[model samples]
Target: MVCGPDVSTHTIAFNTSFCHLRDTSAEADSKLSTLIHEVTHFDDTFGSFDSIYYLRESRKAVGTERSKVKTNADSLAGYVVWGEVFYAS
Candidate 1:
């Protein structure tokens, strides 16, 4: 799964793997920030066998699913907010 420029609004699953901007050059800071954001979701869903099994067995847990989405959204929002603050200061 290749994430687009606006991955913040994208909904991605745990099983889905992505390699976005395969050719385009991205800044190190930008890439690291993106990776940090994406990895949080990956860790939450695939951190343990129980988590993996839960997703597989349920075909998607409602609460877990919602929580993951919220977490990612909040993280991105927070990143932007703090990044602005840091630059302004």
Candidate 2:
């Protein structure tokens, strides 16, 4: 589910499968993060919380140079497509 462009509310389910893509560990981890990020949005009880806030804060703590990071660092195109699927549902 893509929540908003204003926030990182996009998500995919854990049970959902992906195909035609190479199954590698990094890809798996990236997908998992995308899932967790999106699932966080689906819970009404926790939906009000901002996931991106923590993510950006954490990145800052790690000294990641903001100048080098893409604005859509967490957005995977496949995940975005999956989000569209959720939107249609």
Candidate 3:
């Protein structure tokens, strides 16, 4: 998915696979999480977070990646996803 740096433009394009899965009612949990991940990027201030943030939240599992968790916007969004999903239920 490609999210435009300018939120005011409100431009977001989901890849075919993400669209297919979301449209077909597949991977419900992951789809929601991924949606919020994209939203995080969109909500980011003036696209300031993009240059340094990693897109793959899964990378947090790696020991080297752990050090950057505090600065990782993706990981922060992911953690929010998990927390929101968990508490909302």
Candidate 4:
């Protein structure tokens, strides 16, 4: 997936595999929210090597999915929140 900068235009283009996983059966608002979620990734890695390095290392463990718990849309939205909460406990 290619996400645009954090400006007004939150444009994103998903590859065929991603499109298949993120089926169009979902509501438009939900899809838009998913796009916003992806944009957050761009926001995190905008110009930070540490963030990029973290992503690279994480991918090795989680592969492309980035989560060992759940690979659903919820993971995309809540991974960071859940990780922080889980670690705080």
Candidate 5:
């Protein structure tokens, strides 16, 4: 839980694991992916972040499902992996 909208606190702590990469551009930050992925999980019953719904998406076999893969954002959970800047699912 390095990316923390820490419970009972007013801060979101980012995990800087990608900071050491030679690609210092913002696009190189891995957190961008995680943020887009988890943002889709906000469709939960409470309209908030929920793992139950997250796991449910992982079970979808129709086409694009959610877990932790970079593809599309609105339909799955990711930004465009090719030729684009972002996506959300």
Candidate 6:
């Protein structure tokens, strides 16, 4: 999903895939997977969550992927894309 963010409220306008995932049955595996991916975006945009921290927690694979993405640290989209690559659902 490509999230459109509103800096005013720190909200993301979910793209089609995200809306589909959210509207689906909560117990569905795909929904859970989407939740994991989207939550990382949400938290990175609106909360104190840090991608590097979680990447470290996910161990070497995630950490290695994180290293490959060039992020600005202040760019939400960069972080989101990085997470999608390193910590995909």
Candidate 6 on 1-89: residue-level lDDT in tens?
64544445656565676556543322232444344434444444443233432233333334454443333222223234343443443
Candidate 2's TM-score:
0.29
lDDT of 5 by residue, 3-35 (tens): 634334434454565454343222332444445
Show the colliding residue pairs in model 5.
Answer: 73-87, 73-88, 73-89, 74-88, 76-89, 79-86, 79-87
Candidate 1: residue pairs that collide: none
Q: For residues 7-45, what per-residue lDDT tens digits would candidate 1 score against the true structure?
A: 344454432333442221122223334444444444444
lDDT of 4 by residue, 26-80 (tens): 2222344445346554543322112222222333334443343133332333344
Best candidate per lDDT, number?
A: 3
| Global Cα lDDT for candidate 1 | 0.33
lDDT values for all models: 0.33, 0.35, 0.45, 0.36, 0.36, 0.39
- Per-residue lDDT of 66 in model 5: 39
Error of 4 at 35 (Å): 5.1
Structure candidate 2, residue pairs in collision: 11-38
C-alpha RMSD in Å of predicted model 1 compared with the true structure: 13.5
Q: Report the lDDT of model 1 for residue 85.
A: 24
Which digits, one per residue and each the tens of the lDDT, describe model 2 over residues 1-89? 23333334443434334343234333233444444445544444234334223232424422343332222223222224334321221
TM-score of each: 0.24, 0.29, 0.47, 0.31, 0.30, 0.29
Q: Which regions of candidate 4 are displaced past 4 Å?
A: 3-6, 20-37, 41-50, 53-56, 59-81, 85-89
Scored by TM-score, the top model is 3
Stronger candidate by TM-score (3 vs 4): 3
| Predictions: Cα RMSD each | 13.5, 12.6, 6.2, 9.0, 7.9, 9.3
Q: After superposition, how far is residue 5 of candidate 5 from its true place, in Å?
A: 1.9
Model 6 weakest 10-residue run by lDDT: 69-78
List residue ranges in candidate 6 displaced over 4 A. Answer: 22-60, 66-89
Residue 30 deviation, candidate 5, in Å? 2.7
